[model samples]
Target: MTTLSPARALPSAAEVALARESSRTLSAYLQTRAETQQIEIVDDQGAAHPVRVPVSALRLLVDLLTEIGAGNAVSIIPIHAELTTQDAADVLNVSRPFLVQLLERGEMPFHKIGTHRRVRYQDVIAYKERIDVERNKVLDALAEQAQELKMGYE
Candidate 1:
């Protein structure tokens, strides 16, 4: 039920280049194998240590690296994590007041603890997905209408 902290700042130019290279190399290695792989890690003291990593974790790391390589900030939230209203609003890219309105309207489920409200991470994600689908549908309908009216839409 722990909440994740805010996303880190975007990767710097050097970090982005390193992430892109590392992601490419790791992705290629992953494609060749499905089992746990041993990778060497060098410490600041120049001592090399071999570590065994699960394929699943490596895949997740690759995804994270890819996003960082693209200069995007990233944060990981567990599906079952509970979030504060501000955290949920940040995830939805909406204001906290607007999110409270949605909670009051039951657009997404939430529960109150004492006086503060808490929302499930999965519920917030599901709500966002539903909103995105509806937005796409509306945009598609508008495009179709424009085409029918020959309003310079093809």
Candidate 2:
């Protein structure tokens, strides 16, 4: 597990709470893309990049930012595409911890940058496509049954 050191003099509880109450969604955890802050990250290919992020994604970025400010999260924002563990989780509509399980199970490919892990956009898309195919198959079976009933009482 990665150890995170809390930043000094970051946003106060009142400030975060106010932000939370305003958004009333991510609970100050995430803001809109335009409103959220920027963060930098490095990809598996050893390339540095910057990532423009929304609030949910930016929350983690903010922590990473305050940890190693400037050249840290904000600097690497340029290379962000299908990035971040939480973003992958968002794509899958599951928790980040669960997505980490998928990564461990070899269901998704991810790479480690220093202590952080990053997931690819294509991998999430492929997983989504796979799920859609399975769901379609079930729907098709039900449709076939409906067609049979339409033909007769069976």
Candidate 3:
């Protein structure tokens, strides 16, 4: 069980601009049907290193860059990583007490390690997806009701 660190600060304005440009270039290149791509890295000594990377990894990089470009902070957690209750709550954008209640109610799976509760990253994500689907369903139902009532919500 690995613990994740707290998220870093938001990207600076210059970083956002650079990320936007880089993502645009990489995204355009990714439009090709290639399985892999070669990229060059220049060291401090001005030496160039050509490295081959998978398209999947490049796609993920592009996504990270896109988020940074939008001035948003991002963190990458492995699917199998374990998270503390607070960390899980942060991921779900909820209070720690609320997350604890959900855990106690068995809405999500968790385990205790020396009196501390730990939740799997995958489990937290699954719970979030489940609630998101339910919320969307209720929203759709409400929209339909509003339309039927001629409430001008259409």
Tell me, by lDDT, which candidate is best. Answer: 3
Q: After superposition, how far is residue 36 of candidate 1 from its true place, in Å?
A: 1.3
Q: Comparing candidate 2 with candidate 3, which one achieves the higher lDDT? A: 3
By TM-score rank, best first, the candidates go 1, 3, 2
Q: Rank the candidates by lDDT, best first.
A: 3, 1, 2
Q: Candidates' lDDT values, in order?
A: 0.93, 0.64, 0.95
Model 2, 82-120: lDDT tens per residue?
467887786678999999899899887889988888876
Regions more than 4 Å wrong, model 3:
32-34
Residues 1-154, model 3: lDDT tens digits = 6877777999999999999999999998798788999999999999999999999999999999999999999899999999999999999999999999999999999999999999999999999999999999999999999999999976
TM accuracy, model 2: 0.41
- Residue pairs with colliding backbones in model 3 are none
Which regions of candidate 2 fall more than 4 Å away from where they truly are? Answer: 1-82, 146-154
lDDT of 1 by residue, 55-119 (tens): 88899999999999999888988889999999999999999999999999999999999999999
Task: Report the Cα RMSD per candidate.
Answer: 1.2, 14.2, 1.5
